[model samples]
Target: MLKTWQRCTSCCLGNKHKGDFMHIYAIGDLHLSGEPPTKPMEIFGEHWRGHKEKIRQHWLETVKADDTVIICGDISWAMSLEEAAQDLDWLAQLPGRKLLLRGNHDYWWTSLAKMQKRFGEHFEFLQNGCIMVDNIAVCGTRGWLLPSAEAFSAEDEKIYRREAIRLELSLQAAAKQKPAAIIAAFHYPPLFARTEHTAFTNLLHNYGVQHCLYGHLHGENHISAFEGLREGIRYKLVSCDTQGFQLYKII
Candidate 1:
C-alpha cells in the first residue's frame, strides 16, 4: 500500500538513501502549505483536488528511499528562514535526499549560504552551485523568464539582463566542476520564443547543458508547454501542472 501524507504550512524535503545508483525525481511550483487557490493550485488544482492523498501516494509509491529528488521552487510562504525551517521540517520526513532551488515566489530565501547551513542536514540547495550524486553532476538557478511574445520596455530589459547575469553565474559554477552530464534547472522556461537570441539560451548552449528542466507555467499552459529534446539538449517541463513529477533515468 502507498504511504499517506499530511500537509503543513512549513515543509522541508528529506534527503537520505542507502543505494548505489542515484535516481532523480523532479517537481516544480509545488507552492505547498501556501495560500490556497493560489498560483500552484491554479496550475495543479484540478488534478490535486481531494487528491492530496493521491499526490502523496504517488510520491511514496513512485520514489525509492535512495533516489535523489529535486523540488524546483516556490517551496513555502515563510517570511524568513527561521519560519521556513518550520516548514522545511515537513519536507524532511518524506523519503529520499532532496535538492532545492529558489523560485520566484520565494520571498524569504536569504543568502544561499545561510539557507544551506540551516537545511544542510535534510536538503541541499543549488544557488550558483553544483553537486555530484552517483557521479552525475547537477547545477541550476532560479531562472527568470525572458520577455518573449510581447515587446519589453527598457525597465523590463534591465530586469531581464540582471537575471541573465545570475543565470550565467550559476552555469559558470556548474561548468567549473565539469560534471559528467550537466543537469540544469530553473523556475522559468529558458526559451519560450522562436528566436534563440535570448540570454538564457545563449548561456545554456555555451555551457552545453545536456538536460534542462523547468516549471512555473500552469493551467492550460501545461498542454502547450514544451517537452523533449531540442538539438542535443533534452528539455523537460516538470511543473506540477503536468499531473505529477517525473522519474528520470540519467543513464
Candidate 2:
C-alpha cells in the first residue's frame, strides 16, 4: 500500500467475482484525490458541478457494503503514489468492494500484482482481467482508440489490434465463470467518436457481451450526446469526472 494526501488503498486482487443479481455501480475517471475545481464551470459556463453531490449521495444511499463498484479508471490525477494515497482514502470511505481499471492519466498505478499485494484486503485493481459478480461475468480493458479504416495507418492498426487482443483475452478469462450476464468495461469507448460500429465494438458484439461501460470523453469533446443504451443491452458512458461519478445501477 502507498500513502497519498488524504487516505490509503492497497491494490488488491482483481478478476475475483461472486453471486447473482448484483446492484453493480459503474463509474470511472473521477480523478478524485483533491479538492475539485469549481471554476471550470464558471469559466466555460458548463454544467460540470451539477451532479457532484447527486452522485455521491445517491451512491452512499444505494450501495450496501456487499455491493460491487467499478471504478473504470483514472481514479486519480496525483503524480505519485504518496500524492495519490490521500485521494484513494476518499475512495476508501465509499461503500462496497471495488473493481478498479486503469486510465491514461493514472500515473501512480503500478503492476496489477503489486496492486494485489498492496490492497488485496480491500479493492481490486484490474488490468486485462476478469471476475464474476453474482452470476454475472465481468471483464475489463483500458482500451486505446484505434484509427478508423478510413484513417487507418499501419502502426495504428497494429496497436489497436494488440489492445483488441488484450480485451478479448480478458473477456475469455471472464467467460470461465459461465455467468448469466457479461459486462465489459474500458477507459476508452470500444467504439469510435460518433461511429458505433467500430472494430472493437464488433468484436465484443461477436462475443455476445451483453453490456459495456466506458469513459474518456468530456462535454467539450463528447461525440455521442446519447448514452449507449439500446434493446435491453447497455452501452454506458461512465466518465465520473464529467458525470460527477454518477452511479450506473445494473438491475
Candidate 3:
C-alpha cells in the first residue's frame, strides 16, 4: 500500500499533531534542461527519457500550493544564469515553496543575491541558512566529495571541511528557529560508507537532527546509500532518478 502523507510525516517526526499542519515533499537531481543549448539527461541514460514530463505529472498530482518541496540539488543543467532562466521559470510554476540547495553540477548558481533578485520568493536558497514552515525547520548546505570518492584529493579535503562548517552554520540557524523538528537537506551524502559515521553525521547527531534528506548518488552508487535509522538519525536518498521521478513525501 502507498503510504499516506500524514502517516509518513508523523512517523518521521514522532509527532502526529505537527504532521497534520503541513505537507513536506523532497526530490533532487532535477537536471532540468530547457531550450536548445541545454543538454537533456536522456543523453546519459534511457531512464531519463521524458523525465521532466514524468516529474511534472507526478508533482502536480502529489503536491499542493500550501505544501513545501525541498529540492535537494542539481536543479538545472544551465551553464549561466541567463541560460538557467527558462528552467528556473518552469520550477517556479510548480506547486509550493521550493527550497533549493546547491548540487555539484549547479554551475549557474554563482550568486544567491542574483538568484533571489531574479526569482524572488518563488524559490528559496538553502545555503548557510534555514527556514521554518509550520513546526519544521529546514536547513542544509552544498556538501562535498567524500574521502572514499575516486576523485578525492588534498584540495577536496579543504572543501570537505569548509562544507562541514557551512552545514554547522545552517544547522545553527535551524536550531535558533526552535522548531519541533529539524530536517537537514544535503546535495551530497553525509556518509560515504553507510556503516561508518562522518563529521557531517556527527554534527547532525550533536544537534539532535533526526531526519536527513540527500541526493547526488545514483545507479549502482545507491548500494552505498545510507538510509533508515542510524545513531538516532534517519537518512534518505531523494534523487529524482532514485525516487522514480516522483516527490518523496517527507511530511
Against the reference, the lDDT scores of all candidates come to 0.67, 0.68, 0.84
Order candidates by TM-score, high to low.
3, 1, 2
Q: Which is the winner by lDDT between candidate 2 and candidate 3?
A: 3
- Clash totals for all models, in order? 9, 19, 0
Enumerate residue pairs that collide in model 1.
Answer: 10-87, 11-87, 11-88, 12-88, 12-91, 12-92, 13-91, 15-97, 16-97
Positional deviation of residue 157's Cα in model 2 after best superposition, in angstroms: 3.2
Question: Model 2 over residues 1-251: C-alpha lDDT tens digits?
Answer: 11111111111112233223336778877755465632233243354454445557878888988789988887777777667776676677888988888888888888777767766677876667687775666788888765643676878777778878888887677656555567788888776444456656765665667788887777666555346564334687877645654687754
lDDT against true structure, model 2: 0.68
> How many clashing residue pairs are found in candidate 2?
19
Clashes of 1: 9
User: Distance from true position, residue 239, model 2, in Å?
Assistant: 1.6
Q: Write the per-residue lDDT of candidate 3 for residues 15-134, one digit (tens) a residue.
A: 544545558899999998895436778876899888999999999998888889999999898888888899999989988988999999899997888988988769889989888876
Cα-based TM-score, every candidate: 0.79, 0.78, 0.90
Q: Name the weakest run of 10 consecutive residues (lDDT summed) in model 3.
A: 1-10
The TM-score, computed over Cα atoms with residue i paired to residue i, of candidate 2 is 0.78
- CA deviation > 4 Å runs, candidate 3: 1-21
Q: Compared with the true structure, what per-residue lDDT tens digits does model 1 show for residues 1-251?
A: 11111221012112222324446778776666532323344343567563334455667877778788878787776668886665577678778888898888777789867876888889898776676765456777776656664666778778778877777777667666645556777887777633455777677777777678888887777565567777567777777656554344433
